[model samples]
Target: MRLFSLLLCGALLTGCASPPPDDPGGTWINQAAIDAARESGRLREALLAYGPNLEWQIHPERQQASYSNGFELVEGRLQAVGAGQWQVTFYGDYEEQLRLQGDQLTQVASGYWPEQRFARAPTRGDEQAPLGSSFEQALYRDYLGGDWLIEEGQGQGGLVRFIDNGQVQGLPGAERFALCLAGDCAAMSGEHDSLWLQAGDQGSPWLFVHEGNRLRIFEAHNRAQFDEMPEYQPGPQRWLLKRR
Candidate 1:
């Protein structure tokens, strides 16, 4: 009787240890997998969705959407709710549903209409293209996204903004400034000659360094060479910019 009881207890424990059944709608996809697919050029279709203080990049190629603020979609399902309309349900920390029609996608919870639009997936070459030097490009990718205010210096020391359209603006009184990345230079007016006129294919005159939430800007003939100079110190060149 004692041996039989022990065997029964063992069987109960084994059942308890088993994982729950997978969701029938879809399988869980992680960020690493999504990034891998994007890097390898396997992403066939993409969607960009915006909400209040949130953004989501959806890849239909993998049936996954990367959400902002760590609100990710582990698994998702698309069901036809009506003609020319489909309901997209994403399973994550909590379940979220969005309405989709053609290229437009809307979030049901927020009632944010026309929240999503189709976009092309960025290729590996697009990701690797240098905005400045390798270091500046790394910093730019990680920290340069929104508006920034230059705290100190002359002329250009006020509002320096970085836009998603690959443009930089708010330089003192100048409202618009184009960004020259690597070998590519977007057309700029002759008015910009007062500032650095000749931008090299390798780097920019305005060098950016990030420390915590603040970004520092420095002016140098060659930012890459300035970085290697023994006298170069981030503290002295005070054009500190704070994100707005």
Candidate 2:
């Protein structure tokens, strides 16, 4: 009878409630939703959606829309005057004008915002090409659709080059790699992986880590001291990214 009661209790518990399965993706940050929150005033909600240690931020002004973290990078301004019409201004040394639809952003003037855009700059220990689309989407679009190839040492393989229309030859060491189309090399390499760009490093100012079988973008600043100016290297004691 005691054994029967134990079985009955187990059956009742199983029928009433079951333990939940672990999240396959673990904790993830939704960059788009965070960006949307900035556009719509739900920053806290967005932050709550992501787990701890995941940093993000949104900087939208009367004439610009910018979100930090993840892979999407746009140093620009956006102005919304209702009717789904938005005026986007790209920031560099000069200002570039662009028009944004629901999902498609197009450059209105030539010579300003180039029709073709480069992918995010590659860091050390990477071999992907960096071309196609724009850095804006390269950082945001998770399922970027297309084929990418990479060249390592002297042989061509399934990697991506984001430098020139995803057509550039594989990069030699020391040259920056670009985010390409194919998922090949989408994650990390051994020591040569995407890293956070350090501040005042004279190179790029941000870093992206292709770890955990996924690409995670981080904002970093360099505080290294050298006899001469050494090139960037992945290491600890680096500035980690904060919420954008």
Write candidate 1's Cα lDDT for 1-244 as tens digits.
0000111335445432322222111111122223322343221111112222123444344555443322222344555556534455655534455544433344455343433332122211122222112222222233355677777655445677654333456654333333322111111211111112122233233334455457555553322354443222222453677776
Off by over 4 Å in 1: 1-142, 155-157, 173-204, 221-238
TM-score of each: 0.29, 0.24
- Per residue, candidate 2 scores C-alpha lDDT tens digits across 32-148 of 433443443333333334311121111232344432333344445655544433454555545434333432333344553223211111211111212112222323233322333
* Winner by lDDT: 1
- Cα lDDT for residue 152, candidate 1: 65
TM-score of 1: 0.29
RMSD of candidate 1 to the truth, in angstroms, is 20.2
Q: Which ten residues in a row are the worst by lDDT in model 2?
A: 19-28
